[model samples]
Target: MEIDYSQIKVIGFDADDTLWVNETYFRDAEIAFGKLLSEYETINKIDQELFKMEMQNLGIYGYGVKAFMLSMVESAMEISNNNVSIKTIQAILDIGKDMINKPVELLDGVETVLSTLSKKYRLILATKGDLLDQERKLEKSGLTDYFHHIEVLSDKKEKNYSRLLNHLDIKPSEFLMIGNSLKSDVLPLINIKAHAIHVPFHTTWAHEQVTEKETNGKAYKTLSSLKEVLNLIH
Candidate 1:
């Protein structure tokens, strides 16, 4: 594939799995909390109740450490006959805080790739989730300098992409979104006639990974990793 860098101006990116590890951390915590919840109730019952609440509130709270921690608390209380203690709640909150303050680690080769792309395209981060949580991660990741603009939205859908394009004052055809999550990152961009390069992750968050097969889809391309983006764009 031939890429004309001159034809592209702004490049938008999804934050979580796109640039750094996100859901895996949450999954780990959930499993740990599951062990504790299982001591109080059946594992299957706990999982069902928690999953239902999470799916319901995904849009309202967005993705963040705090909201997830609270979801665990609610799930535990609901399943355990409302016998959850203050200590258990505190422990969950502590875990979430630790994740927030934890040192940010960039995905392998992310720094180098973004550094190369920044020089050629106007880099814009178009991540959608909790504002403060996403902001803290971006700041701590040491990647703030690599992007020209950072956007934190309540959601990433077709309308969000359209608004971003308008704010950038760039035509949809001139921008490209490079990230994981085909549903959120690629399909929305494709809807507006923009280019998208999907970098699939091994384990995607349940909310982010919705299977939609489109073999004949145009305006969107899929790859195995972010490193391939360098080849496609340059």
Candidate 2:
């Protein structure tokens, strides 16, 4: 079913995989680290241990390159019997820096969709991540101008979403949340009775993936690509 954009006064978007290639970069880094860890253990073992570290750290550090880099260092030490050297530490940090330094690659149809939708509705970039990292990416992507406000937050829980709704002076029905991660973007907004559009992305980061069993009905509508949103808007 196509949603009517006439009532959607504000459109909030999740920054990473929704608009640009995000988790793929982190996955590349993880695969690189897996190769490094393979020198000491089996590839499967490395994957299991890294996944464990990621789960443990997500509760502590949340998400971003910093948590990911530290998780890598800790995983290397644990798997290698605490034999981590300066080189290993440097290698982990290097991967983190690589992700930060990587060129921002806007996903297919993002520019066209955003540029088209911006003309009608108030566009807001609502993303959660490391502040500096997200800000740098927004500047580099050259798509920043389309947004009237950009929220760089460490978390996108119900409280933050509510605050943003109030800050924009918009009701839940008047806004639509467009994002990839159902856990971070869809669930919280749904809790507040907000409408959301889900654009399922390929290559989800380990931490952000939500299995089918967790989804709620009536809260979100999944789309194949963002271009669909443009079609809905205009």
Candidate 3:
């Protein structure tokens, strides 16, 4: 089926994996965390429990490394029966700090794509994460000037997207979202009658993974690279 972008005046980009390296760091941190708690349980068990903890804590901690670090701490304590040492807890904090401090590495053709699209359309950043952390990354990325507006959302759901579009005075049909997460960036926008393009990253957080049933009959474009987006939009 053919999709139309002729009415799309505003384009929104997801920050994390869509524009730069993000989920990869979380994977690395998870591995380190597993090693730290290896004495309490097997690596596989630790990984599973940590993911469970993260899901349970999402509403409380929201998203970003700080939330993840707290989940790690909670999981460590639970798996160790509250016998985990302070040094290990400190190690978890250090892991998150290291992740936050890691340099932002933009994906291939990100700048070029943003630059090209900005010239032709209204580009806005619509990403969800810790405001300070997301702001820090945007500053570090050096791609801030390309966007007309930057929104760090608390969450990315149909309602959130609708609210954002309404605030921007944009109709759903006039907005397009580009991101890596099918759950956050693609499905929500599609639900609100907006256009979305999925650009999958190599590693994805378990929370962001969506089942086939959720995406059944969904109409969206999936491109292998950001460069391919130029073909779709204009």
- TM-score winner: 3
Tens digits of per-residue lDDT for model 2 on 103-208?
9989889998888889888899999878888899999999989999999877888899999899889998888899998888888887897878889888776667
Model 1 global lDDT (CA atoms, 0 to 1): 0.81
* Model 3 bad stretches (over 4 Å): none
Q: How would the candidate models be sorted by TM-score, starting from the highest?
A: 3, 2, 1
Question: Model 3: clashing residue pairs?
Answer: none
Error of 1 at 75 (Å): 0.9
- Count of backbone collisions in candidate 2: 0
RMSD per prediction, one decimal?
A: 2.0, 1.7, 0.8
lDDT computed for candidate 3: 0.95
Q: Once superposed on the true structure, which residue ranges of model 2 sit more than 4 Å away at CA?
A: 1-5
Backbone atom clashes (below 3 Å) for every candidate: 0, 0, 0
Q: Which residue pairs in candidate 1 have backbone atoms (N, alpha carbon, C) closer than 3 angstroms, thus clashing?
A: none
lDDT of 1 by residue, 76-97 (tens): 7887778888888788787788
> Comparing 2 and 3 by lDDT, which wins?
3
Q: Give the alpha-carbon lDDT of every model.
A: 0.81, 0.85, 0.95
Candidate 2 TM-score over all chains jointly: 0.93
